[model samples]
Structures are given as C-alpha cells and as structure tokens.
Target: MELLSFGDTGWGDELFKATFMTILVALVAFFFGFLISIFIVPLKLSNKKLLNYLGNTYTTIFRGVPELLVIYLLFFGGSSAVMFVAKIFGYKEFIEINAFLTGSISIGLISGAYTTEVLRGAIESINKGQFEGAKSLGLKKTTYYVFVIAPQVLRLSIPNLSNVWQLTLKDTALISVTGLVEIMRQSYIASGVTRNPLLFYSFAAFLYLILTTISLKYFNQLEKKYNHQP
Candidate 1:
C-alpha cells in the first residue's frame, strides 16, 4: 500500500511520469537529429570541398565538446538567440523556451553529431562501383541515392545507429540538471525530501535498466530482420 501510494508518499507516480517524459524527450531528439544526419551525411560525402568542410565542422564542434557543456550552452543561449531572430522579424516579446524544448534540441544536436558519423560510414561502406553503374545507367544523383544508397545505408548502419540511440537515451538523464522532470531529477528530489537516497536512486536505476533492456531487444529484432533480407 505504501509503495503504491500516489505522489509524495511512494514516488510511484512521479517516477512513472518522469520516466515517460525522459523517453519522450529521447524520441523527439532522436527523430530530429536523425533527419539532420541524413543531410549532413550526404553533404560530407559530396565531392565539393566546401560542403565537406561545413559538415566536418558541425560534427567536430558538437562531438568534441562535453555534452553537459553543450546542454548548458544551448539552454542559456538558445532562448536568447531565438528571441533575437524573432526581434529581427519584429515579433519579439521575450520568447521563452521551456526545459523540454531546450533538452530536446540540445540532445538532438549532440545525437546528430554521432549520427552523422554513423551515416557517413554506412554510406562509404557501399561499393563505389554501384554508384558508377547508377550514373552510367543514366540515373540522376537524387534517384540513385533514393533507390540505391538510402536503403543499403539504413541496413548497414542499423547496428551502429542503435548504439547511438542507446547513448542518446542515457544522456537524456543529464538534462535533469536543467530542471526537466526526467527520472534523474525526480529521483534527486525524492531522495532529498524523503531522506531516502538508497531507495529512490535504486528505483531510478532499475527503471533506466528496464527501459534500456526493452529498447535493446527491439533493436536486435530489427537488426535480425534487416540482416535476413536480400
């Protein structure tokens, strides 16, 4: 009865809610970052030097910096930057970004950095002869990539990119420092208020482990399915 109590007494509701929010944040971040990676990967693979340089710079700066620093910089500067742009468009009234948006973008940016590398590696792994054949067959670059590179790249990178997703999911806990109601934040509060650090933190650990295990199983199944395909 005590363990199942709502809100303050048992931490049952708070833990569940925070866990859900954490998963939500990770999902949103992964989606946006994955989209960004698609563009970055191809541009980096382009023959043009400028595009390569730009993509390299993006990956370098994001990946080289600590994630906590990245989160802090984005959380503090991102809102101001948004409002600055809004002001130029003449619609500024102190635009605010809630912690969720801040966490999502910050994590997304970091995830994009790693995802770009994974995508680039996958793209490079494809046979260069295939690309030449596509060109020789009069397929446009867009068509070649759409019909040729994208499918193979997705298949090749699923294992590596699944690792990236796991990294991103765990890193979401860092966003607790920004005051998001993630599992870590909730556990911190519960430990302090209830003066039961062991109990609350243990619960948090188990919840995170459960989430990761479930995600790993799905990724493995996906990998198996793709692997068995022609």
Candidate 2:
C-alpha cells in the first residue's frame, strides 16, 4: 500500500501518468492504424495489379518484421531518412522526430498491417447479394457502403479488431525503448529506485489488466449493440 501511495515517497504518481501515456499512445495508434487499413484494404482489393501488389507488399513487410525493430528504425533512423528527402528538394538541415510521434507512427504502421487483413476479410465475408440489392435500389456508392456495408463490416470485424487492440496496447511497452515514459518503463524505473521489483511489477500487471478489462467490456457492448441491428 505504501508503495502505491500517490506522492513523492511513492512511485504511484509516475506510474499512473505513465499508464495514461500508454493508453493515449494505444488509442492514437489504433485510430490512425484503422484509418490506414481503410486505404490499404482497398488497395489490396483494387482491380489494378500495381495497387494490389503494393498493398500486399506493405502488409507482408510490416507483419514479417519485428515490432521492436520497427520502433528502433523509426526513432533512430527516421530523421536521417527525412534529411535525405529534404536534400532532394534542395533543403539542407538536420531533421528530428520526437519520441511520441515516432512511437505512434511505428505502432500504427504495425497495427495497420494486421488490420488491413481483418477489414478485408470482414468485407469479403459479406454476401454479394447484399451489394447487388443496394445497387438495384440505386443507392450511391457512398450511401451503399455507409448504410448497408459499413455496419456489418464493423460488426464482423470488431472481434479481430479487439484482438488487435490488445496487441497494440501491449506493444506500447516497446515504445519505452524510444524513451517514452509508458507503463513498463515507469515500472522499471520505480523498481530500480525503490528496490521493490515485485511490488512495482505487480502493480504494472494490475494496471494492464484493468486496461484490457475495460477494452474487452467496451468491445463486447459494441458487439451486442451491433448484433441487434435490424
């Protein structure tokens, strides 16, 4: 209890703030990653062979690579890559990306890779007859997807997206390597300073469990709500 107290003598405040950072990182990454999946899924499903191949290559590469390595590359080498692009445009200066942006982009890219497949599979699972019916009703393309397809796609994909969310939440721990003060990083510092590894580590575990519990319950509610659609 003393170790979990919220004051200077305890590591509680730091850990609590770090947990918030972890959640924030995961939330932003999830949103951006899902948006990325929107584009990538269509690219993979595109009639053009080039777009299809590019999408396939993106998913293949990101999914094949380790997430940690992706983080390292983004944090360590991203500036150099940006500088190279600047030179091509007749600019000369060092470029730097902060840890927060680096972590978000790296994790989002990784999540986007897996999400592409999930969204594509969900859309494909919907019956062709549904689309045909929408078309026969003279629904515009936007209206067709918005009213008829998007809801079902989201309904079918929520389970997989939840799994992906869990994976992303845990992956934020890897962001600590880039010097972001997330849950695992805070726990590491607290344990080292207090010489109470067991206590701090356990606290970290409890926090993670809380995060997952809330996420699962929320997704389950969504599942139930979507399931009852007319």
Candidate 3:
C-alpha cells in the first residue's frame, strides 16, 4: 500500500535498511559468540578445577539471565564501567557505549553460552580412539585439531549451530530497546508514525520468516555437504 511506499511518502526504505541491519547484527553477534565459545570450551574441558569452574560460571550466568536483561546491562552498565575507568585515569568526560557494540556483545555472550554446550557435546562425542590414533601418527597438537578433530566437530555441530543461529536472529529483536533501528525498532517507529501497527508489524514478521527460511535452507545444504564427506 501507499504506507509502505519508498521515499518520504512511506517507510519502505527504512524497513529495507532495517532488515539489513537485522542481518548484520545477527551475523556479528553469532560470530562473536562463536569466538567466545572457542575460548570457553577449552576452559570447560580443562582438567584444572579453577578453569572448569570459571567456564561453568560464565555459561551459567549468561544462560540463566534473560536476553533483554543482558542487553540492558551491557548498554547501560558498559557506559558506566567505561566512565569509571576513564575517571580513574583523571579524565572526567561521560562516555556512551555504541548501541551496535552493546547489542552484539550482549547477544554474543548469550549465544556463546549455548554454543559452548553444543561444542562440548560435539567434542565429547568424538571417540577416544581418534586421539590415540592421532597420537600414534605423531601429529602435532595443532595438526590433530585442525585436520582431525575440527572437521568432525564441525560436522556434528552444524545442526545445533543452526538452532543457535536462529535463536540469535530472533534475539536481535530485543536490541530494538537500544534504539538500534533493527527490524523491530523500525517497525515500531513506522507503526507509530503511520498509526498502522498491524501493517508494519506484520511486515516485520514476514521479513523474519524470509530470513529464517533462507537460513534453514543454507544450513541444510551445509549439513548435506558435511554428511557426504569421507
């Protein structure tokens, strides 16, 4: 309809941009979270009690907290922490955290918690004989992980990682509270301005459905590719 037209007469451009932003946020957050999980997974798998405890604590806290709460804490508390550190250096200016960073980091922390568990399961699923076999082959630690362990872990974990990606995509909606102009935020703004909440919100839902369906297809392809690997 006219309400969804491009340019000043409608919010088509805004919605389009917002959809892109949503994708960007989800991607950055998911990758960031995966990086975090890479570090935490070793901690959890370590034989040292302190290392294992620390990893468990990180995952438990992040997993137990609500995603919205995590965003609020990162958005508000991050600025305060930065300012505190700045003041300690005799600088008194107020600092505001970037919305994109806050959103990504918050979602990333949550995503990492879930990813850590998924990775742990995948790693544990690997047979003990593989480690012995790699050792007998005189492979270096790095080579063993890269060539042997990594591939199987990735293959086994792809299915669960797909779920994590979907959850991360949905979680991006919570970042709207940070005024990030993502899909939900743009829909809210357009709805408020046009007084057609149903139209814009429905459009937002459609956009999300498209994203999820495409992601599902991609993940399915990835799984098939990995399954075919010898």
Q: By TM-score, rank the candidates, best first.
A: 3, 1, 2
* Model 1 CA deviation exceeding 4 Å by range: 1-8
Residue runs of model 2 more than 4 Å from their true location after superposition? 87-91
Backbone clashes (count) for model 3? 0
How accurate locally, in lDDT, is each candidate? 0.91, 0.91, 0.94
Answer with 1 or 2, whichever has the higher TM-score: 1
Summarize candidate 3's per-residue lDDT along 65-120 as a digit string, tens digits: 89999998888899999999999999898788889999999999999999999999
Q: Which ten residues in a row have the lowest lDDT in candidate 3?
A: 221-230
lDDT head-to-head 2 vs 3, winner: 3
Error of 1 at 125 (Å): 0.6
Q: How many residue pairs clash in each candidate?
A: 0, 0, 0
- The superposed Cα distance between candidate 3 and the true structure at residue 181, in angstroms, equals 0.4
* Model 1: residue 117 alpha-carbon error in angstroms: 0.4
TM-score to native of every candidate shown: 0.94, 0.93, 0.96
Q: Which ten residues in a row have the lowest lDDT in candidate 2?
A: 221-230
Model 2 collision count: 0
Error of 3 at 212 (Å): 0.6
